[model samples]
Target chain A: MAEIRLEQVRKAYGGVVAVHGVDLTIRDGEFVVFLGPSGCGKSTTLRMIAGLEEVTSGTIRIGARDVTELEPKDRNIAMVFQNYALYPHKTIYDNLAFGLRMRKMDPAEIDVRVKKAARMLGLEDFLARKPKQLSGGQMQRVALGRALVREPDVFLLDEPLSNLDAKLRVRMREEIARLHQDVGTSMVYVTHDQVEAMTLANRIVIMRDGHVQQIGAPLEVYDRPANLFVAGFIGSPEMNLIEGRIEGADFVAGNLRVALPPGVQASGEVVLGIRPEHLALTTEADGVAFTVRVIEQLGAQTLCVGEAGGERMRILVDRVDSWSPGQSVGVRFPAAKLHLFAKSSGQRVETAKP
Target chain B: MSSKATIYGFLFVGLAVTLALIVAPAVYAVSLSFYQMDSFVGAPKWVGFANYVAVLQAPEFWRALLNGAIYALGSIVFQVILGIGFALVLNEAFPGRNLVRGLSILPYLLPTVVVILTFKWMVDGGIGIVTKAVEAMGLPPINWFESPGAAMASTILVSVWMWTPFVTTCFLAALQTVPQSLYEAARVDGTTAVQRFFHITLPMLKPILTVVVLLRAIWMFNKFDVIWLLTRGGPVGATENLAILSYRHAFNLFDIGGGAAIATISFALLSVAVLIYFWVFPLEDD
Candidate 1:
């Protein structure tokens, strides 16, 4: 078990930088997920940590060793790739035992570890079978077992569940969590799916366009996103970001005005942010006017999409009444739930009044 | 019904060409083994298995068969080795890689006669650069074709030089299909470059390698032009293979039945060898 430290790690392909300088330290045994959309350098950063991609600048440390120039094998880290990347020609047993055998471990010990990993992954019956004979989930388990047998200092997974079907992805996600808990080894997972990051990570490092937007606990980032991107990216159905300006302690857009939260300082242009679940249905006179354009019944909660104060907004409510398009209603944005960001910079503005 | 018609139409064309060009000539040759004739239009006498027995009993026939095996095996071994080496070099990322890849296929693109003559020119006793290089290196001037060993070596050398590019191209294409992640996984699995090649690259290439070797073997076994143009089965038939022996018996010696019998035997042997090869290295993985 070792903590990983990335100090100002940068990756550039010619003049096109893939990953801008990223600095973060992963605590020992921590499950840190690098979360981002495609081409956001999350995978590139994970690859650099795995030593599969050469870092353009900065150093990578696993534990106390400066493994910046070391080969991946020498760094004592095992990686599971997006496609599983299991040796197709080899049997499941051989695939699991490959790393151990390469390290010149004892035959008995390698066999023991292979058996244990197979049992852990429920692949004991498939030891002699090649990768093609297995399903997608089984193949990914073999990939995980391959990493498990090595007992490496850290585990790097690059979208390990992306190829699996939805139901299988959930099962594998739980399996990975169980594996991590059982072994207590540090794992660095990369994915574009924020749900996977939120569900699987002890800490989620959210990135955009090669720059890290925020790094915190799943709900910590969900509750308090550092920037506009994180605020929209971390939640389901997205947060409502209404463009407006602050004047006389109220956020005003067109003819609509709402009392701002206390301690608002130096905010002329601001983007009012609130989640769909935070809006409450109230009397039309006491709240912002909302024209319902589409109503989607989401089983327990109904999601209503419409315009509020001349800005498109989504509000979620547990309602039994059937709603249709063109219906006007009033939705109140709770003060504590309202998130405010600087319109020009997209950074969160301090809401506490002096 | 239209798709069915299209499929049948394509199949019929292919079958007609195969039967007319390949099956007919092969059947005619085999049938000639049963007859004794001085010329194609002469009064032919039925010989049955007499020609086969006579050809099989000849020492030159056996020697030619052995020479063919040696030539095919030697050429294939060197071709596969050098082909893989060249392919591995070409597969790496380098400047001018496409230009080098295009240039590498030059020897294979040349006609057989041109390549043979070029080989001859390069090893000529007086004006050859190879001879001059050997002399400059203070090495004994080697006989390229006068001796039996040198003659056989020269034929195999020229064949490998002319055809290694084809094998290299096949291997290079196969190498590209190997997913780069497998190599990266191997690297992370604690493998050096050589280990990765053996563990991942070679296994992934097995199916293609099997087919390529079989093709090169069959073609080299029946090859007549390169040896004929270079040595002409000379130096007391040192480089003579089954094809050369069959040609000599039919054209030079006018033993048509004997030539046909030799050709028939070579065909049967090759079919048996191919059967054995498939049995040993089946293409489909279990």
Candidate 2:
């Protein structure tokens, strides 16, 4: 296994820059996921590391070798494309053996590796089957198997599960996590889906507009997002960012004013970030008053969207709680769970007692 | 009336037109091949298998069949090779690609007579560009049409020149259908450019290649106009294909029965060739 490093790597098509200078180092055997919305340069960064795209500037080093100018095959890296990209004409065995054959490995060794990958992927019965003959999940495994048989230092997967259905995606996600564990190879996966990033990545690199928003462990980024974008992007249903100002231990926005947690500092325009699960529906009088707009019952839990301080805040409640639209409710944010960001730059602001 | 019945009523009209225009003439030609008929007028006399026997015995008929085979083979070989080469080059992105592709297809769009006449003028011995160039190169001011082998080569060359664009167009469309990601994947998998073409491009183009070859083979087998317009099946019948031979039997000799017999025999031979081709390169499982 080798550590992959990129120092100020950039990509441009003519005058339009797709990826700015990006510097990152993926530790040995680390599963790093580049997560972002569409056109955020995450895939471009992954492609650069795979040597599929040329870096406009700076150096890319895999272990001790500077592979910025090398071809993908010469980089000793394997990539699974979004479409799976299984050779439609070749059988599963041939597809798995393709990279090995390209490297001129011995036929016996190729057979052993191919069979081992097939057995691991549960594709033993599909050795002779063509890609078109396999289902979506099976094809995904074949793609994974093709990459696995290469035994490369780093494995690059570009949205490998986006093409599968919901149930299949979850299943494949777990399978990929298991494979990563079994192989213990360094992996760099790219996806727009946060669930895949959170579930599969040891460290998630969240990007937006050709810039890295944040990079940390899944829950680390979730609990303490680096900026407003990271705060809004890392959670489902999104975190509630209420634009307001902090004045003398009170946070005010529109007609609502709530007491701030003690030891909080920096008084000026700030945005309060609170996740849905962090808010609780309570009848306490000191809680922020809200008018419920909608309630979504989700089996064990229920989600309520309510208007609080002229902003829509979503709160997760128990399914047993009977809440209707237009009902008045008091929502409380735990003092430790409040995230404050500077309104001017959207950067996270630290609030600690001096 | 119900919608189903209305749809069937419209389809019945189409079927009737096809039967009258295509099937009826084929049936008439088959029936006429077994009888001796005169173009001038009179009832055709039933000759049983005599017309077939006479055609088989004729030396000119055998020579014409050989010429036809060579012509078709020569044209197809050059057409497929040059067609694929040109299509691959044109498929790449470059400045003025649309204009180049449009110009390349001009030969296919031009009237067959125009292309034939142009080639005839260019290859004429006197005041001909090709003949002049040959003389300038210290070669003989040779007769392009008077020589047997030269006439056959010339006709085949002209056929390839006029129809290669059609093959290129078909191949270009087929090449476009191959996803770009497949090539990217192959590159990552360590396939060289040549290996990618042979392994991915060629296999992906198999279905189109089969259809193109099959259609071009059938068309070139019975091709008449280009050969007739260029050499008139002449230079001692060196360029006389089965289509020209049948036409001459019908018109020059006014033996309609003999012409029909040759046509029927050519049809049978072409069918066998097509069948063999399909057997050798079966279509992929759907």
Candidate 3:
């Protein structure tokens, strides 16, 4: 196992840059996920690390050796592509043993490693079957098994579960997490799905337009996002970012006036961010006047999406079946949970954490 | 009910065309093989397989059959091998790739007679480019259509040149259907470019390759025009394949029944060969 390091890695296709200078170090046994939307260069960065895409400028190292110039085969890494990319003609056994066979390992040892990976991936019964004979989930496992048999220094996965059905994706996601735990090898995963990043990654590197937004643990980024994009992107019911101005210890936007957190440093135009779950429904007389437009009952939590002082806001609260559309209700934004960002730069304006 | 009627109507038309154009001619030819006739207008007398027995007894018939096999096998082998090589080169990203691909298909697009005439012009004695170059290199001028071996080689070379573009186009289109991820996966799996071609590219192309080879084999075995135009079965019956032999028996010798017998035998041989080829390399994905 080895740590993968990228120092100012960049990728450009002619004049257009796909990945800007990205400097990141994935520690040994760490599960780092590059999370971003489509065309945001998350997959490009992972491909660069895997040696599948050439780094236009800068260095990448696997362990202590520079691997940016080496071929993928010489980088001591295995990748599971989004489409599973299994050898369709080969049986599962051959697909798993192909790498070892290419490396000219002993035939007996290749058999041993292949069988071991198959058993671990619950693919022993599928050894004689071709890729077409297997289900989407089974093919995904075979893809994972193919990488496992290589026993490389690092594992790179490019949205490996994106092709499976929803339920299968969840099951395969669990299987991947379990595989990582069992192998204890460094892994670099790329996905546009925030849920996958939040659930599986030890550290989530959020990106936008080829620039890193924030890199932190799941809850850390959720609790304290570094920028407006990160704040809005990291949450399920996206965080409400209201365009407003900070004036005299209060945020003012149209007729809405909410007292700002104490010791706020910014003074000009600012964007206030607050998560849905951080708000609460109170008596009409207790908090700000909120008119509920729609109510979504989500098992234990009822999400109230409506206008709070003429600004769109979503308030998630414990089951409140009493609420309905066009109902007059009061919602309170806990001061401690309120986040603020500079509107000009879109960077977070640090406030005291409660 | 309307859709069903439409399907049946289309099937009836297709069956009618097949019977009229293909089956009818085949049946007429087979029936002709069992009769004795000097010309199409002459009274054909029922010979009851006498023409087949007489043709089988002739040494030229056996030699023509052997020559046909050699020509077909040689042309198909070279065409397919060179076609695949050119397809691989054309598949790669290059500056003028589209232009090159268009030019590569030029040979296949040309009329067969035009291509044959061009080949004849290129290898012409005294003034042809090939003859001039051979003389410049102090090598003996090639007797392209004089010697038996040279005549056979010339025909094979012309056939390969005229038809390799068709094979390359088919293989090139097949190469496009392969997913790019498969090659990346192979590279990650520690395969060099050669290994990747053999393991991934070749296997991915198998289904198309099977069909292409079978089509090329059948066409080359029965190919008549290119050889007829280039060598006309040679100086000493060297390039006289079954097709040429059959044509000569009918037109030149005025032995219509003998020509039909050879044609029937050639058709039967091809049918059996096709069945065996499919048995060895079935087109369906396993």
Candidate 4:
């Protein structure tokens, strides 16, 4: 296991910079994820750490050695790409043994490590089959097996499970989590999927436009987002942000007023950030009014889509919540679950009043 | 149901007509090869293996066949290697790359007759630029097309130059279809540029290269115009190829049976090569 440190790392393609100057430290054995939207430079950052991409102007120290100028093989890192990137011509056995064989390990030792990885990934039966014969999930396992056989200091996965179907993505996601627990090696995963980041990462590094928006444990980042970007990106259904004036201890938008916590420091206009499940439903008299547009009954929970201040808003609720389209209902936040940010900067504004 | 049957019947007839249009000439040639041209006025009489016997016994026919093989194999080996190399170079981004690619295909587009005549004039005996260049280098002037070995070398050289561009074009088109992600994967696996070519690019190019090489081989084996124009089977039949020999037999010697026999033999050789190619690399398997 090795710690990774990026010091003022920047990557530019021509005059257009893909990765801005960023600094991060990943402790040994930490499963850190660089999560962002598409076109964000999360993959670029992970590739830099793997030495697949040249560092424009910074040092990438993997475990204590500066690998900024090293080749990918010299850096001793293995990466699982978004497409699995398995050699289509080689059998699963050959694919898993390729890195070990490249390192010139003894033949018997190579066989042993490959078998162990295959057994761990449950790929013993498919060892002799080419990648074309295997399903996407099986190919992903071989890719992971290829990395595992290397026993590299850092494991870099570039959205390895994104190619699988929905059910398979979940199963493979859990398989990755299990693999992490079993190996305990440092892993840096990059993905546009928040659910994968939320579940798979021991520490999440939320990035946007190549900048590290926030880095902390999944729940830590989810519970205390650094900015409006983090607030909206980490949660499914997304954190609902309503722009309005924070007049004293209450945030008002048009005719809707959701009271904020006491001593809230925002004056004029500010954005109200609340998770969908945190939007509590009540009788018409108790809270801010909501007219439901669509109700998605997801068995245990329902997502209510409605219009508020000319923008569509989503509210997650238990499936038993009774509401209909065009019906006015009161929505409230329990103060402790609510977040308030500055109107312009999007920085969090702490408060104690509601 | 009656209308559908009529449509199907009409489609079958059309297909048969198309097949017959191609097969009739070949069938007639085979029939002609079985005869002896005893007289020019009457239809040739059946000779029963006499034409094949005469062709096998003739030293000129045997020499031409050997020269053709040398030309075909030599052209094939050089074309595939240099074409793949040139294709790799063109696949990358270089200054004036579009112009470089366009110019590489220039030799392929030139008329075969013009190309042959130009090279002939440039390499003709003493006044020829090629001979003069050799003499200037303090070496004895050599009669290239007048000697068997030199003629075969010239034919192979010109064939490689003319056809390698075709293979290069094919390889470049195939290279474009290779997913960039595959290369990135190779790079992350610590594959160097040379290793990536062998491990990733080459295997991915297997299907296209098969088609390209097969076509080039068949075309080179059947090629007539350039060889005929330059050598004309001169220097005591030293460079007589199947195409020129067949033409000389039917038109010059008026030996229609022998000409037909030579054509059949060439066709058989080509058919066997194509059959072996399919047996080795099936399109459906990949």
Candidate 5:
């Protein structure tokens, strides 16, 4: 196992820049997920680390060796592509044994290791089957088996589960997380799906455009995002960001003003972010009244869509509550749960904990 | 008769005439092969397989069969291999690629008569540029059309030159179908360039390669025009193939039965190839 480090890594294709000056350090045996919107350069960053892409101008270190100039083989990294690129002509055994065969490992040893990997991936029965004959989930496991048999210093996965159905994706996600636990090898996974990032990663790196938005523990970034983009990107329903202004010590969005705690420095133009689940409907003082637009009943929980003042919002209301469209209701969330950021730059404005 | 009945009667008459124009000739030739020269007015004597036996035993017919096999083997192999090599080079990003591709097709697109005439001019006696170049290089000048061996070699060369680009076009289109991601995947797995070509590119091209090779083989086997212009079954029948042999027997020999017999044999050879093709690459399970 080895720690991977990137120092000001910049990748540009002719005139277009894909990854702009990224600096990150992934610890030994750490499961780091690079999560972002599509074309956000997170996959590019991961590929650069795996030595699949050259650093336009930067250095990458795996353990103590600077592997920036080395080939992918010399870098001792294994990568699973998005489409599970198992060799279509080769059997599952050959697919898993390909990297080892290139190294000319002992045949018996290769057999043992390949079988062990197959056993772990539940693909022992499929060793003789071709990739085309396998299901999407089985092919995904074969891809994982190919990576596992390598025993590399770092494992890189590029949206490995995007091809599978929802249930299969969940199963594969857990299988991957468990594989990491057993192998104890450092991993860098890239995906646009934030839920996968939250469930599987020890630390998540959020990106937008060509810049790194934030990097921290999944829960830590959720609780305290470094910027508005990170906060909006890390959550599923996507954090609701409304344009607002700093009026005296409070931030005001249209008719709603969130009164700031004492001694808090306010920016001129700011944006307010609050998770839908954090906001609740209650007949309490300081709660805002909203007109219901739509009620989506999700069995035990209901997702209510409404307009608070002129701002449209979706709230996750617990328990079965009947609320018709155009009905007036009061909604409130803890004041500290509200996230504040500068409107121009979208940088988070630090605030006291709730 | 009703209007519809009249139209139907006219359509049947037209269909009969079209069939007579195309299908009647083959049937007439086969029937003629069985009859001897005695039936010039009514129906000739029924020889029954004697013509087939005589044509099969002829030395000229056997030589033509041998020449036909060599031509098909030589031209198809050279065309496919060279065509694929050129297509691979063209598939890459390079300066002047469009110009190179356009220039490469010049030989394939040239008319058969023009190609044959150019070769003939380049290899004519001592005045020919090729003959002169051979003499200058201290090599004996080849009697291209006079010597059976030399004539066959030249015919093969011209045929390959004329058809190679056609095979290249098929290969180029097939090469485009190989997904770029497969190559990337192989690269990441430490597969060398050669390994990637063999293991990935080659397998992906199997279905297309089979089609190109089979079609080229069939077409090259029946080729005649260029060989006729270049050698005309030269110096002891060195360059005679089945097509040329059949034409000569029908015209020069004035033996329609013999000509039809040779044509039947040629047809049998092609039919055998088609059968083997089906056996070797049957739809999917194979």
Candidate 6:
């Protein structure tokens, strides 16, 4: 295992910059995931690290070697593409043995490694089958096995599970997590799915518009997002950001007003960020009133989309709290859970501890 | 039910047209091989298998068949190799790639007669630019059409030059359909450039390669225009092929039965070759 360091790496296509200067250090055996929406340059950064794309600027070092100018084959890295990218014409055994053969390994040793990988992936019975004969999940396994057989220093996965169905994606995700644990190799994974990042990454690098927005542990990034983008991107059902003005001691928008958390500095226009789960239905008089537009009952938790303070907001509540559409309810945002951001820049506004 | 019937009715008309235009002529030609008709006006005398026996016994016919094989095989080998090589190069991303691709297809689009005439002028023994250039390079002036081997080689060379682009275009189109991710994966797998071509590119191109080779083989085997225009089976029948021989027999020698027999033999040989090809290289993946 080796640490991967990117010193202000940047990539551009013609005049269009796809990845801005990104400086990151992934420690040995650490599983760092780059998470963002499409066209956010997360995949581009991953490919650059794999040496599949040339770094237009800055340097990338894997272990003690600078691989900035190296070809992908010379980088001593293995990557699993989004589509599995298995050789369709070759059998599973050949696909797994391909890298070993390319390295000029002995035939006996190649066979041994191929068998081991196949056994690990439960593909022994399908060793002679071509990729076309395999199911989506089986193909994914072959892809993972191909990388596993290489025994490279760093493993790069470029949205490898994106092509599978929902149930298969979850299974493959779990398999990848177990594989990382078993191999203990430094891996850099890129995906637009936040859930995958939240579950798989030891440290999550949230990106937006070719820029790294936040880098922190999954819970840390979830609990304390760096900005408006991270706050909205990290969580499912999304964080609710209600635009309003901060008066003397109260935040007011439209016909709604709620007391700000103590010592929350700055006034004028601000966006109040609160996770859906942080908002609660209450009968208190100090709560903001909401008109529920739609109710989505998701078994364990019920999500309600509603209008609060003249802005659309999502509130996640326990399934026990039954609220129908058109119901007018009072929602409370506890002081500890409130996230306030400057409206003009979307940067977080620090609040003093109470 | 009515719509289905209408579709079948349209299909029936198409089948009838194909049978009348294509199948009928082929059948009539094969039948004519069994007759001794000299001209269209005279009644055909039943000759049984005498015409077929004559064609098989004729040393000129056998020599012509051998020349045809050599031309077809020679042209096909060069065409496929250069086609795939050019295709691989053109598939790479470069500036003005579309313009290059458009220009590369010009050879395949030019009329066969024009290509033949152009090649004849360039390879003309006297006052030809190519001959003069070769002499300037300190090489003896080469006769492109006079000697038997030289004539066959020039015919093959010109055929390859004109048709390689067609194969290239076919391969280039097929190459585009191969997913780029496969190459990226192979590269990451530590495959060198040569290995990538053999393992990834070649295998992915197998189905299309087989089809192009089969089509070019058939077309080259039956080709008459290029040979007729360039050498006209000249220099003592050096470049004579089955198609040219059949034409000579029918038009020049006026041996209608013998010409029909030769044509029928060419068709039979081609059918056997196609059958063997299919049997040896079954297209279906294992």
Number of the top lDDT candidate? 1
If scored against the real structure, what TM-score would every candidate get?
Answer: 0.98, 0.97, 0.98, 0.94, 0.93, 0.96
Question: B1-286 in candidate 6: lDDT tens per residue?
Answer: 9999999999999999999999999999989889897786789988989989998998999999988999999999999999999999899999999999999989889998888888878877787789889988999878787888998998999999898889999999989989999999999988888989999899988999888889998999998988988889877888899999998987788778889999999999999999999998788763
What is the CAPRI rating of model 6's predicted complex? Answer: medium
lDDT of each: 0.93, 0.90, 0.92, 0.86, 0.86, 0.90
lDDT for model 4? 0.86
List, residue by residue over B1-286, the lDDT tens digit for candidate 4. Answer: 9999999999999989977886787898888899988445777798978999999899888888877777778899999999999999999999999999999999999998878877777888857899889989999877787677788788788888888898899999999988777787677666778888988899988898888888887887787887788777766776667888998998799899999999999899889989999999887444
Give the poorly placed runs of model 4, Cα more than 4 Å off: A307-312, A352-354, B1-20, B38-41, B125-132
Model 6 interface RMSD over true interface Cα atoms: 1.4
Estimate, for each residue in B1-286, the C-alpha lDDT of model 2 and write its tens digit: 6999989999999999999999999999988888898874878999988888999899999999999999999999999999999999999999999999999999999999999888888987687899889989998776778889889889999999999999999999999999887888888889999999987999888899999999999999999999999989998899998999998998899888899999999999999998999999898762
Instruction: Assess the local accuracy of residue B219 in candidate 3 as a C-alpha lDDT between 0 and 100.
Output: 92
Native contact fraction of candidate 5?
0.50
Ranking by TM-score: 3, 1, 2, 6, 4, 5
Q: Note the DockQ of each predicted structure.
A: 0.76, 0.71, 0.83, 0.53, 0.50, 0.75
Q: In what order do the candidates fall by DockQ, top score first?
A: 3, 1, 6, 2, 4, 5
Q: Per-residue lDDT tens digits of candidate 4, residues A1-354?
A: 788999999999999889998799988988999999986799999989987788899889988799899988888788898888787877889888877776778999999999999999999999999998989899999999999998988899999988899999999999999999999999999989999999999999988988889989999888888899999888888898888887667778876677776766679878888899998888767766678899888889998988654545788988856677887767777788888888789987775432
TM-score of 1: 0.98
Q: Write the per-residue lDDT of candidate 5 for residues A1-354, one digit (tens) a residue.
A: 899999999999999999999999999999999999899999899888877788999889999999999888788899998998888878999999988998889999999999999999999999998988999999999998998998999999999999999999999999999999999999999998989999999999998888998999999999888898888778866677788788887778888766676666676888888898888778836588878898888887888777786888878768647678988888885677878888888788877753
Native contacts, share recovered per candidate: 0.76, 0.60, 0.83, 0.43, 0.50, 0.83
Q: DockQ winner among the candidates?
A: 3
TM-score comparison, 1 vs 5, better candidate: 1
Task: Report the lDDT tens digits of candidate 5 across residue range B174-240.
Answer: 8997777678777778888998889888887778788888888888888888778887877678888
- Candidate 1 vs candidate 5: the DockQ winner is 1
The residue-level lDDT of candidate 1 at B122 comes to: 91
Winner by lDDT between candidate 6 and candidate 1: 1
